[model samples]
Target: MYNKELIRNISIIAHIDHGKTTLVDRILEITSAIEQRKMHEQYLDTMDIERERGITIKATPVKVMYTADDGKTYEINIIDTPGHVDFSYEVSRSLAACEGAILLVDASQGVEAQTFANTYLALENDLEIIPVINKIDLPNANIQETISELEDLIGFTEEDCIKASGKTGEGVKEILKAIVDKIPAPSGDSGAPLKALIFDAEYDKYRGVIVHARIFEGTVRPGDKIMMFSSGETFEVTEVGIFTPELIPADSLSAGEVGYIIAGIKEVSSARIGDTITSADNPISEPLPGFREVKPMVYAGMFPGLPEYYGELRKALEKLKLNDPALVFEPENSPALGFGFRVGFLGLLHMDVVRERLEREFEIAVILTAPNVVYRVKMKNGEIVEITNPAKFPNDGEFEEVEEPYVELSIITPSEYMGNIIGFVTSEKRGEFKEVENAGKNRVVLKFIAPLSEIMFDFFDKLKAISRGFASMDYEIIGYRPSDLVKVTILVNKEVVDALSFIVHKDKEYAVAKKVVEKLKDLIPQHQFQIPIQAKSRGRIIARTDIKALRKDVLAKCYGGDITRKMKLLEKQREGKKRLREIGRVTIPQTAFLALLKIGEEDK
Candidate 1:
């Protein structure tokens, strides 16, 4: 038992490509947390997808022993968080595992939107923020300017910043020592019932579900019957372990210790991120509720190209859910995309992780439909429905009113481009500016309130373009509004495909959605029957296009020496065709079906 003062827990937060993981790698190497020569750069990004993409999708926690100047050996738990906005929620939960955070501000980019987004949450949590200026080795590294930004954003002084080059071993040792000296110890009564906030959990085929949790109060050991405060499901702990970043068996985990526990639980959603775990026999009276149900801000239908891969599709999702509990998939039969699942995610990167994981891990090629946002609907009788799938949408006459999810967005950009960004956000994105503040002579921060549905597709792309790629944005769900929204439904062969449909605000630019549907038509090889693709709204058809069958293509002509390529192509097409739940004479893909339900698929 760590009686009074043996544990130090901290989380690292930074914007995308701001050297968060790189710093973590160096810390591990310097502290000997990793085996010599066994470690590589960004070693915390263990998954192939993460390393290849250079982003951390899943949060990883590592335990290291550091000796402080006060001559005390403290057990420090370091939690590495994702830097992208998509994993903001994940970052939020990971903070629950630590008492403090090391905020790395890129010297060149200075403080970014994601940095502001996460730091604000850290402040709300009342956690100490240890300011670190990373990438000091960059030729353009403005250490002085970044330190000033940190002082403004995080209430730290220029002299207090730890200037370090995570790439080179420069001044990184100070960060380790400062973590022990600067950050406060975790505060909670150990006598209380065991309460662990699960930031993340993964399934090991051999060990079952291993949950990574921060013990807020009390200790946990093997043979304890744990209940997920969220699911209310109980399971006996089979193993107790600590993070070597790879699980290492432990005798027990006490308060403030971040570690893993293996239970017999196999399914992923049962061990969701931000869910709390407590002893069922002696359950905590009040579990720490960290968040609302992780709602997918973005939704899309995933289909295998071949109808034969329907089983493969399920297997892929099952395996993905093992590692990615945030990915929600339901066996959805779409008219256009065929056997597809209406998959939900926290944001765009989260969605991308699922898709990329599916393709890379399963070696299964898939053609995914365009993403759409959830819509809020209210009946005259006051019935509220949050629709994730457009296929489940009620017609206009069937609804008293409808609205979409809205978010309060904050953008930090160069002052030179503020005018351009503001105009584009208001005009092209249906955004209403709330405030604009002078961040510095060359920088400004603009805050706006807009619908989440608007930014789901290419919102960042447009923001980057209008600002000449210098702007950074962050957003949080504010509330729901009566969206002047419409459904863009696509029909092939005059039949609606449910997967191709989605909901969107009517006032925003429809050019992106319009182009996506056109691209879908181009990618989808038509059958013997000429399939007519049409976009509709409220059961009224709006936009129309046709997918003409490719001429002079045969399996026999392409089968020599590259059967795998031919099979993959046909498999994708076959999967799409299967989604065409025969509605009368039309055979539609699920993409067409779901696409039809969003605004662009529908006409004005």
Candidate 2:
């Protein structure tokens, strides 16, 4: 019953919306793991948020028993990994669990920003890359051009590539066959001390920390003492499970197969993604290698719609933390916004996903501040400090040394937008434009190395606008360099609010400061009394804004309703009003308050 030499461990990877999930669905259908009568599309990305957003946020593992033409049942463990650049760490984490990857390219879109981003991750892991051109049968499909680009960009030979329409199940069997041929067999000894690389793990009410890892060496059975390297945790393996496309009870999983280990560890840190799981006694010499810490690239302040909902917000975050280990939050007090949380994320996409999940999954309405890149600045005393919130900065004269993280970015767009992109980048005082290459007669590629802080927000929106939605962009973190930057703090009623501040390059500080004050003035409603809006730097107010008095309003008019009905409506308005932090006796609506906190100006 065991055929170790024939098993294939592979992961399917691609850009967002590039059909990696669809391809997985087709593979499951062909292998008959999924009952045909109720077969669906994008089966692997089962989260409701994923389906609604059409992006994969978490990686899932499935197993299919395929009967090859030689009449042999080969167990193929296929892992469906997240496809977005924000989750590149997830990609790297899951890649360690597989021997090969199917890099799916959109037939018409060719090599997109995310496709290149994830492909580079696969290459770095030294996994065999199987090129697959998907959606071959679409009306706008440009298979020939995409094939040529794949050869040029990723160095994949035409003969080594597979073509398939995941929608109609065309060429589905061929892709499956390629996995069996291209990926390597499991080679570690089952007798050696058990070691596995944890790709994804979660906690269950009944099962404790359920870890999904690929057995690299040795075998583990029930009642085995397991230690997780990441958390320095030790717990006895209570149960072993296998994939029936879903977790099922198993006696043990041998080397090269993906399985789950349930231990009595309760904390989430015990089974962290990308951590190593090994035996406690008969201890492994070394933990499974290739572990890297995840860092949060974006920072923001999260507040409740009302002060009474602060407890509700905490519960939502705690629940979300159960699923998203990458999210980090700490209690932060803002003079203007009152008590809130300063949250961190891997990047913008990661931040957006967390926000969307909070709103959609928890049904908690929140006030989110503008995201800023974390900065490492050296003070006048020559000591380096990591700064996230702009309010943490000292007076400009006190800082003699400063450095900001930079990134090398690649952007591809239609030829017509090339000039606009170049001008926009140069004008914004961000990255230095290196060069532009002609991909074809109508397509152009541009490269730039920029300060991460400069392009934190509006870059995506601006790029899409210039390219008419045809540009795809990607970025990688480069080392930091010294920068001449300053902090511009916004003051409402001559009072500085830590949440209403930002860091900017020296040359552009005044302009950005003006915009910030003006936008805040527009968003912050007229107060009961006149209020002053000003931007200050080094104790000097750089810009000023005044909010006029709140002149008029009609009280609730419930003529015919019962006392309970009137009271309920009044309660709603009262609750909404109470949630608004009264800064010097002025009420702020939730929507305008969030807008004033962001970086970019509103649309005209």
Candidate 3:
């Protein structure tokens, strides 16, 4: 067994673009985890998209050996987590596997919206937080003010905070010393029954699935049979290892140590995140608590641009799902778009990243339909149903009430922009103000309770635009509330396009429908016959637009002829136009459906 006193398991948490990965780079270099010649920027970020986008989409685990000022050695396992709100679940899982965390705050930007959310999550897990002020070398650095904000927000004094820059590696040694001096060693019973928490997992082609876990109570080794408490699936471990930048084989992983278990499992889905592992032969009576399955909050349909690539898209999704259990999909068919899958995501950013990965990594171009939020429908018969797509929404007579998810939203902005922010939130977005308080000299925090559906679509972008990029917001799913909801259906030439239908609040239906029809009018090409685009609610037409047909050149052939002959030619032309109208079809472009994304942007 290993000494729990010398092992420190910690995770790095921060807001987006707060330099978490950069700090990890400096740490690896100072600890000699990699040779100087092999060192590079963002070494732990393994994906090319991550490097290009400058965001960590996945949480990575690594181990390093550091010698402290006390002349003693310590084994530090650093779990780097994603900073975006879309990947908050990743942060939750990483926190479960660590005893302490380094709360990295941008020195100039101060604490952002996501920073507050993630800090609360870490505190909920009972992890000791080491407040670190990062990016101090930048010209706009406001170290003193940021430190004061931290003192107020988390009771961190100047002495408790570390000031450093990820760019020049300033204060790297001191930060390392602080980690050893301030953060407590991990605590666990090595002799107790096996209970390891699987924080992350990956699929390996040659060796099957590899699970990254932290041993909580007992020792785990090769040849030991382990059971996943959540799935109740058991398997024999083929190997045990730890990451030193790369995987290094280990004889065993005892309590308070972070490492990996390689089992001969065929799929990664069998080994899920946040699940507890225990020795099957010497099992624990109960598994560790706080484990819940990840649920998706956003839904959209993805259709292959080319109908022939349907099979390829299916295979790619299966492969991607093996690595991401949170991504759920099922076969969906649309009359306008063809066969595809209705995919679910944790949020909009998650949906974008998955789409990028599919197109860039798998080389498949796909069309995405309008996004929908889950709704709870109460039927007159006293039955409740959950619907994610408007195509499945029941008739008005069938449902007595519709309830949509709501969120507790918090916004941080400068005092000067408070008026604009409040006006937009209350008047256009239907937000209910809770309270407001001053965060610092010129910064204010606004709290509101708004429909999750309203904020889920382009709310952040608009907030930033209106505030001139000085505002940041965060939200948590509160619960479902009754709404004045109606289903808006779009019909093309009298045929309903399921992909173009959606549910909206009844008050905003007219404006939303008007914008959609106007955009569709410009996107659909002209046809031989008039094509009418209509939006309907409860079998009543609410908005309409028609694409006029192109004129025929029937008069070009009649140069000089009798009046009767010219009239006959004109009649024949009219007959031809009627025939064309009978058979003409309107092909809606894929870009037309993209207009639905900006339907609410024109509200103000």
Candidate 4:
């Protein structure tokens, strides 16, 4: 029942620390969406970690009403998206719900790595770009330089850029007016078959899965039977609601609208982001385009600290999975760590976020093993296998060829640190340099074709360290490439521990093995007898260390004893040592496994 011309659906996109959340706060204030006394800084950032880190971790959507000077009231829907490269999927999904995007750039810092990455995504979604410069009130604000960068990198001219400060509340009104004047309203047929794009969803114990979607065509109402285009599952719509910063029940949602639909879906997996929703009775023949599934880029084993809590962890994972469909996990058992789950994530940050949520939300402490990526192995018998866990890797000569994932990586950093970065990526990480170009004054963009395995570790931290925290990066999977990779097994007292095994490039096997053995030697407590720590790959020992024994001086009090008696005592002590060695089991502490995350830290 609303005119498309009076509605504006837009998303705010920017880099981390670029004040996207603050801008949203300013907009809410100007729109009077919330009372002045009730407003707080970063009002859109609902998570504690988000506020603490000053970053938007989740994409949040809200509705605001603004009365223009032209004596017209407009309904604006703003989707505030996270800017970190790790949350690129979330940003992309949020962008899909909008017809235009406000690209907020830091006035002093200009365009960053994520800025370019997110701008490209918005362009990919065919969203109109409204370039805005934020934090212009700062003393170091280089408005001209930032404008130059925008023009050079994103092809935005000076006339297209708007300057604003969320802190001082300057130019905010102009920005909103621009949204009403410049950004095009969503255009769709409200009478067509129902077609809604599911941008996000959440699980509620009482209401089940609440799907956040954008209506592209037709209208949806409560009690209407809805069907998911991808899953082809139908459920009666229980409720339709919109975010007026709070959930408000609505009679119906029409085309060019962003709202939530509850369809009695208990499992989060049933409602996937990027999936299309349609009416069950008159479903569309084809779903919306760009419906790609999210695939995990990293895999790791998560084991409960207490073995008895495995069941509790499983239930927690199931509950969390309802909200996060990107998370994939399966039951796995480890000889050293006992029962655990092999969880897959979009990236390392996703893994960390999931782990944090597990501990904080579920109150379950878990020990994680070294992360790994899937590898394609061609067996000697001509069968191909994809392995996620190193314990499942084939032995040497058992596989004819091994292939590992590769990526096309792009990094933006200051020109002063370019040489060191090139060396770090090409030599230390085994990446091949593709090209380099000027980004702006004293800034450069470097491209490389590298193994995904390298970036999966501490590559980002290393890059940041070398660049003095100014470097930004983004990457895309470039498919699998054949490589000389091996599964390195760690043995304690001649017993292989599946949890400690990991896949490594064959060239760095010896170095990685040496580091692991060294770390384990320091972490493992001294046994009654010497416990040999060995790293073996392809049935050949690559490195070894021993946790020395804590020997008792059994012969100390034998001053008055005969030589034969002393000798017998010594013989008995030797016998005890032999027996202990034969039956001894070394308990590897969790810290040893955590040391794997510090792979290159010592060198740095």
Q: Give me the runs in candidate 3 sitting further than 4 Å from their true place.
A: 553-583, 596-604
Cα lDDT for residue 407, model 1? 92
- The residue-by-residue lDDT of candidate 3 on 512-537, one tens digit each, is 88888877888888877788899898
lDDT of 4 by residue, 154-193 (tens): 8889999989998889989989999999889888998999
Assess candidate 3 and give its TM-score to the true structure.
0.95
**lDDT at position 34, candidate 4:** 90
* Stretch of 10 with least lDDT, candidate 3: 595-604
Candidates arranged by TM-score, highest first: 3, 4, 2, 1
Prediction RMSDs, each to the true structure: 9.2, 8.5, 2.3, 2.3
> Which residue pairs of candidate 4 clash?
none
Q: Candidate 2's residue-wise lDDT over 1-604, tens digit each?
A: 5557988889888878988888888888888998887677677777787888889888889888898878878999888888766787888888888889999988888888777777787888788888999999899999888887787677777898899998888988998888877788877888888788989877676766678889988888899988877666789888888776678888888888888888787766667888888888877767777787778888888887677788888888987776677888998886556677999988877887888788888887777788777888777778889888878977767777778889888888887888888888877746799988655436767889887776667778888988888899888888788888778777676556666677777777677778777877788767556777788876687778777755333234666857788667756665554444254554455555567666532211
Q: lDDT values of the candidates? A: 0.78, 0.79, 0.87, 0.87
lDDT of 3 at 598: 50
Provide the lDDT at 388 for model 1: 80
TM-score (C-alpha) between model 2 and the true structure? 0.89
- Which portions of model 2 show Cα errors greater than 4 Å? 435-444, 524-530, 547-592, 599-604
How far is 388's C-alpha from truth in model 4 (Å)?
Answer: 2.1
